[model samples]
Target: MSILINIEDLLSGSIVEGTRMEFKKGWNPVPIMRSICAFANDFENEGSGYIIVGVDEVDGKPIRPFEGFNPTNLERVEKELVGYCNLIQPSYFPRLSLEAVDGKHVLVIWCPAGANRPYKVPDDVTAKHKSYNYRIRFRSNSIIPNDEQTTELIQLTAKIPFDDRVNTFASVTDLSKSLMREHLQETNSKLYEESEEMPLEELAEKMNLSQGAKEHLFPKNVGLLMFSRKSQEYFKGAVIELVEFPNGLENPYTEKQFEGTIQKQLIDVLAYIKTNVIKTKVIKYTDREKSDRFFNYPYDAIEEAIANAVFHRNYELQDPIEIRILPEAIEIISYNGADPSLKQTDFDKGRVRARRYRNRRIGEFLKELRLTEGRGTGIPTIVKSLADNGSPVPIFDANEPERLHFIVEIPIHPKFIEQGNNQVSDQVSDQVSDQVISIIKYCSSPKSRQEILNFLGLKNHSMNFKRNVQPLIEGGYIDYTIKENLKDRNQKYVATDFGKSVLIKIE
Candidate 1:
């Protein structure tokens, strides 16, 4: 089966980087085995690399309009590959696909990161006297690792990244065809066109979303995260919790929880924020015709911050990704801090590049969806977005002694903060007139409108309630308990943090 990627994109080095691809004019087993061994090592934990034969390349780029491989030799090549692949110490075999690019047949070798890594092969597979050495990819070329690098490769033994590991609890049937097809379609992969005709198991294999012997295939963790709505069942706390504090964290705040496929959650949360939380403000000056336009918190900055949290958080941990939208700033918290290679200095300068990713496969899926730019640009992107909006530099708090969690605190725009403070003061001083303070204190806990009116010794009238309580709600002192269904018969009123603060100041 063909690998789950756009063959055209792979050749053009658009999606996959040059470091992860090697092009050859012809099939030579000796060097091919070396590249295979190096790719299996996956020294940088950057997911799998591919090798394409029957295509010539200069400076690691494929020369198009390639001379095609002989059609008659296809079977011969496959048969020989089996014997030659076994020469590696761990016996690794790459997935082979004959794809037609520019009407020429090129052999695409899909060398996924091996579960058993640090593989070694004979330097010369054809020589009478063989020398086996550990091989790894250095940029675009495959070469034997030196002593120091070899030691590092050995340390990676049996340390396959979590996302790539097989999920024994899940059967191939657990994989959703619709979600998988949707991803393939979104990525513009050739596999999507043939997905409908393929069996579930066959499709899973073609996509590299399943593992184990063919008789008892199981879905990989990455596959479930990308393709299953029930991913939360397997991965605990695999959801996003968003809390908004118009006043402060010390008072009552509205909350929402998002659960689904990670991609779905990401898209849904972003939409929710844009519709409800994000706000734009215009500042006009009498001396200037052009007004300054800026968002309270730039959407792009928030997008990168939350997307990075989702992509980097340890799924095994029970802590759900938490986004706290405070009046002064937004904080995105995720468990398991940045990689050790990232220093406080790096974070301070907004230049963080991880030595290796915690979830390489997860990064691959997110990048294809255009939700993230996976090559360690998440922090830099957030910094740039905030700077462009005239906001304060974002604060990264991953300096815990044990480095247990990662926190990104993005400050609100200065103008918005000032505006909010002024509005609150004005409401408390100027408009805290008729029964507003009494209503806020009465509704500290959730209370129906009629109950609040009865407490005030007033009759149940919509106009009275609007006059006494609507100002409190509009001033951010009160909130509807059922925010999504504001007009529900059972909806109740409650005092928000801002309202409690007002009562404390006046009373």
Candidate 2:
């Protein structure tokens, strides 16, 4: 039993004798009932507090321990307390306990704050007449409620807010016309011009925004998202934040904040990624043949991820969407508000039908943008792009009623050159070596220098490779045949049987 008070501690303080902490002698039901109510009410305001019994008072304060109450009488006290609470607030019952300290009996009643507020005494005329009403104040002081305070108490207990409160500050004028125009063009270019002069509200209605209406209350959907300028303002909890960590982990070295519309945020976030996250590197296959490359994550896959976040996130949740970039993987998190429709089994079996978006309107708009394709293709696209590039499949995990998190692990491929006796040496640098290997290992059977460079994720550094690859041919590791049809004198490097043998030995 928790010792809320000791005899010595009680003696040292000004404790009211008959409120929660003090008990008057005899079967004083009125004071005890009021104490229960006060204790229950206080629990709502100040978390938890205890009511103690069997303590004596001097000057309205407990100075010495009163003789313990009879153990046999505890059953009566328990029954009465339960009856009182049930008659008062049927939904909430305070937990009660009895204990003995220094041969004296004390009653400890614990009340929990009600989850549904404004609990009232049950509506039985006879019970209401018999039950007591009292308020608990600081220390043990008990006060008979005045009319004003009693009415205030009733008001405090009964107040509950409705769920669908509209934002009066947000109007149709805040929407972006240009963004809506773009979406219209993508969804049906023929109707784009026809709908140009339509009222924003009419457009919102025509797009089936009220399709899932319940009790005449329709939530703002995807069409509103594509057009709304102050969408975040209208939807108080909707915001997307992209954070970039220097080491790609919990502690971020730098962070950028983006708000307003999801489309604008997406564009800004992608630009930030291009500028800060991706890097280029050169991998040398031999002393003569060096390949220029970039990181292994496909640009298309990343775009799909961003589009997914914007379209699928639960805007009803007050949590912001997050993108975390780590050294080994990238994580995208959207507020899901309970388990997602898609499961690990669905992903494993390549069953796209199981996935459902929380925001259908936003998803359709993204599809119109060509940011995503027909039903359930985005995740597969992400998986295939990574796999085709020799990268690992992205992992997806759903957090119930809160978030859906996706982790894409960018695979690093290593270039191997075989000597003999199964001894392989990596002939690539760490920077872009993995990307270079992926290109060499997966490209069509044999490719031109330009073709290999492009396939190896080297589209950005075409000029650098053109100037630097000659040394590899001179080193005897790579051989190229001269063909008049090939405008460049050095047209292609068909890795010789010796080169393949070397690669095999290294592997």
Candidate 3:
């Protein structure tokens, strides 16, 4: 945020504090200091926050026609704020500037994020101040969190990723050397040229799967996912539960749990989707010599959706990733939700989905395995692939309070039910007789009885129209607009899906 807020802009009533902006009536040391502390200790990755003094707020909205800070108190307030910082345990120096709106002024303090994090708010400005109270901004308010919330904030402030933490109960031997070696070779990186010769602990450290201990190394969560032969032993929710519902309800026709190293699990799940979930069909148009091919849903799109769930899901959560295949659609639901740093409107506005991965180590490994294109390219790929395959765009729901699971719903391909039943089959040897082909190829519009006969250079619409146009209509290449009322004066023949497919093939 800049060191200035335009009075005109503020008066325009368009400014919403959202997650970062705060409005204060005056430089009340207690509340203002708390705001500064919260901004400095911000852990939800909201880069930096701004605190504006002199603008009065009620019910989270800034009211109009109110006078801002008195121009006289600006310097005095700055000095007092600077003095308060000195009395605090750790110092926080903010960039202070006086901005004028309609000749009335307000102090804008820019509290940027500092490297020395988890700053505490002093109990008072007393010389013997000793309290180490912490505060954080949640939405528009600064809150002193409860014990559990405090712990989560501390972890977020330390930047301790869930995937990198050491699983103390699991030994380094839990990691499988054979699986690590296979992954290294599959990725084919020069960094792993001597991977086979490296000790298990060293290899695990190299892949960020294990961290060295004072005596014995321990496997990290990411390491367990990659090299551990029994990852499910520690992480009970690590498995992906795949279920196919025949009636689209709780009754499962087939249920399977894929539990193993994540890489292996992803491969197994993808193979299962291709074999069981996806249905391929051969389509022939009219009496064409060749046919067309498509599937119930694009396999590449499915891979993107499933990979996104596994790679970015919050593995610390107790729930497993779910792949539910129903008659109408395939849904991939991941445990936990999206980045809390962003607002729901941000996702609705088509903002960038990922600025940081929930599991950076796992995501990096997937990228190395060519399972994903990192740097926030996965969602766009899924969208484009679905659209190109003539399917509706996939729906993604993140941070829904009720469900609290990231869901990707891909509708079943339209052709899934209508495949072989399509009017034209690929293998029809005489789908359209030669005489009928001559009639359809020459007409742009739907030709009537006499019009078709004239185009075929026949004298009458009697038997000539029957021999030529009748075959085209009955063979499924063409159809009359009013089939039941063919005797109507406006009745005319038009090409069907079978005919259009054939026309393109012949071209």
Writing each residue's lDDT as its tens digit, candidate 1 over 378-434 gives 889999999999999999998656889889999988877574532222222222433
TM-score of each candidate structure, all chains considered together: 0.79, 0.44, 0.53
> Which of the two candidates, 2 or 3, achieves a greater lDDT against the reference?
3
lDDT of each: 0.82, 0.50, 0.68
Q: Where does candidate 2 have its weakest 10-residue lDDT segment? A: 415-424
Candidate 1 global CA lDDT score: 0.82
Q: Between 1 and 2, whose TM-score is larger?
A: 1
Of the candidates numbered 1 and 2, which has the greater lDDT value?
1
Candidate 2 regions with alpha-carbon error over 4 angstroms: 1-170, 185-188, 195-219, 248-252, 287-294, 337-341, 348-352, 399-507
Residue 453's lDDT within candidate 2 is 65
Per-residue lDDT of candidate 2, residues 40-140 (tens digit): 55421433334556665565554455655677888887777666566665445665445556777666555433434444443232453554343544446
Candidate 1: segments with Cα more than 4 A from true spot? 64-73, 285-289, 419-507
lDDT of 3 by residue, 1-507 (tens): 123233344333333224566788876787777778887875554444667787877766666555588768867877888888775447876767566565677777767554356777775654384566888877677888789878876776557457766788889988888777766655443334566678887777655566656487788888887778888888888889999898987764788898887876787777666544666555677866677755567778899888888887888777999998888889999977776654556545444556444676576567555676545556777777777777777777875565477788888767664545656644323223344456567544677777777777765524335434654665577788787887898888777777777766654
Please tell me which model should have the higher lDDT, number 1 or number 3: 1
Give each model's clash number.
0, 19, 4
TM-score of 3: 0.53
Give candidate 1's TM-score.
0.79
